[model samples]
Target: MLSMREFWNIVSISLCVQAQISQQLSDTGHTWNYDDGENDWSKNYPFCGGTHQSPIDIYSNIKYDAALTPIQVVGYDSPGIDHFTLSNDGHSVKVSLPATMYISSLKHKYTAVQLHLHWGDQKRPQGSEHTFNDRRFAAELHILHYNSDKYVDSQTATAKEDGLAVLGILLEVGSFNPTFENIQKYLSQVAYKDQEVQIPAFSIRNLLPVTLNEYYRYNGSLTTPPCYPSVLWTVFRQPVKISQEQLFSLETALFSSNVGDSIPQPMVNNFRQKQERAKRELLASFKEDFTFPIAIAFILGIFVIVAIIIYIIRKRRARQQSESRKRVMYAAAQKAEGTSSIEI
Candidate 1:
């Protein structure tokens, strides 16, 4: 006994409810390479367009503030045979860390949560998210921590400014690095998306540089979507060396898609481009030595000038020696022919 208009209205309302439920169910269906398109990211996650985004290029001319204290990594060398979970989350390989690890340089203590990496492909060797003076390294590591003093948990801290403190270490290709071997050995186990494996405990302190004194600090956001601007970024001045073979393993060992996906895509170049450092000041722990680059350039210039002068002198001496030999040969022929006396 219902009219056609009323029947259609009821059907529409039911469909809307179903759609909302379906969306909520599949909210975790996001991927790094495919779904999170660079151009389309802002469409899905409006926060991708936030002002204070991360992975910025650290220029040479940075403000040196002596007040910025060196970060004290407490409990990093805790003695234990702890087991950690290493997983490939379709974007990059992430290893979960224990809550006991914390840093104590800033105003509030920040507890460790997890660590991850970002790397480039074989063709483009430089893949670090943050670059120094526009120079990129082979890879980069991010150790994520949350403010334990102000927030109850990491989840609550992630939305507020001064919530997260991320320590970034740049990786250069060189001799074998034992510090990274702990995680590198288990990469094959988590080669596919959603795959996880247990890794034996190792000292997290060894992964960082020997000295945490030199670093660049800034206020920025997360590099990924839902780009919350709550991270206090601390990038080290020195780079850690890792072998090329280890880099190859990191680049080729993971797949962006799950095992059952139609196409298997390798998870490489999972780094966000350098974002604008809008209205932000980059503070460095050490003073800028303005003469270092200039001194290097001056030494190289002197070496080049000396090399050119030596080459010119060598060429002139060789030419003179050849002429002298020709003159001696002419004199010997004249003496043998008895024509030297007639010419004199």
Candidate 2:
């Protein structure tokens, strides 16, 4: 005998295998908009206004932590399932991942929950949440996970500190990528809000960068409403590439409105504006070469300034010498005239 409360938690808010693909979503049927309700998220959800927020601006001065090891996964290559449910959750596109897949190398076993995306539109394409060196990419992909060892499921893990781990893959416009195409090929099928489809499962590891050793690690929160500051963020340095056509499809393929609404809104610019990062340490697995390039540019600038100063000094000295010569010649001519007058 399942109580209605238990059933609802398992079905509506579950991100594990027993649950749906996403948790902390529009599951509450809470109406919020990015364009209008964005500034007012704190009015309804107080956590939106809280400190230690996510999608921070990763500046140049990130500290290199030696303990930040390469992220290891258990069963990402083989999902062990034929198809996974894909849905347009009115905010973003989501795909449910099985609990069989989890990250192994972390201190606790962080099981895979679901993966979703945030993107911009044809007019404004910089939709990525986390910006690196103040550069925002075209789109961003988030693979959500929960601490399986500490909590029963993701729904229970949502509120706890250090309970979530999300892998962020930033996308840029480039050549066609087949791994992303596995999900993108089915975009047209689930274009409207609440539209669900069964997309064939593929290797989740392919979604990540080829080299997992280099990444930026930080402590942040979920980018959406009811923003929980539980996520252990890992944003890869190398961005995933997709062609212009693919990016356009992501921007314009979906609608924010449900299947039947008076006015359908294009689901563009679904990303939240970055929040303030107050006194939190940002770590990197590999040391960034920010100084080498800056050092070269600084030396070149100094040389240019010195060259200009030398040119100005030489020009002034030449002009002064020319004026002195003219004065001396005029004086000599006057003296010669006086001598000639005396001889007369």
TM-scores for every candidate against the unseen true structure = 0.78, 0.84
Please identify model 1 stretches exceeding 4 Å from their true place. Answer: 1-36, 79-81, 297-344
lDDT of each structure? 0.85, 0.86
RMSD of each: 11.0, 7.1
Backbone clash pairs in model 1 (N, Cα, C under 3 Å; residues 3+ apart or in different chains), count: 0
lDDT per residue, candidate 1, 219-321, as tens digits? 9988876676779999999999999999999988889878898989899888889998877999999987859899999999999999999999999999999
Question: What lDDT score goes with residue 211 in model 2?
Answer: 84
lDDT tens digits, residues 265-342, model 2? 899999988888878989999987769899999999999999999999999999999999999999999999999999
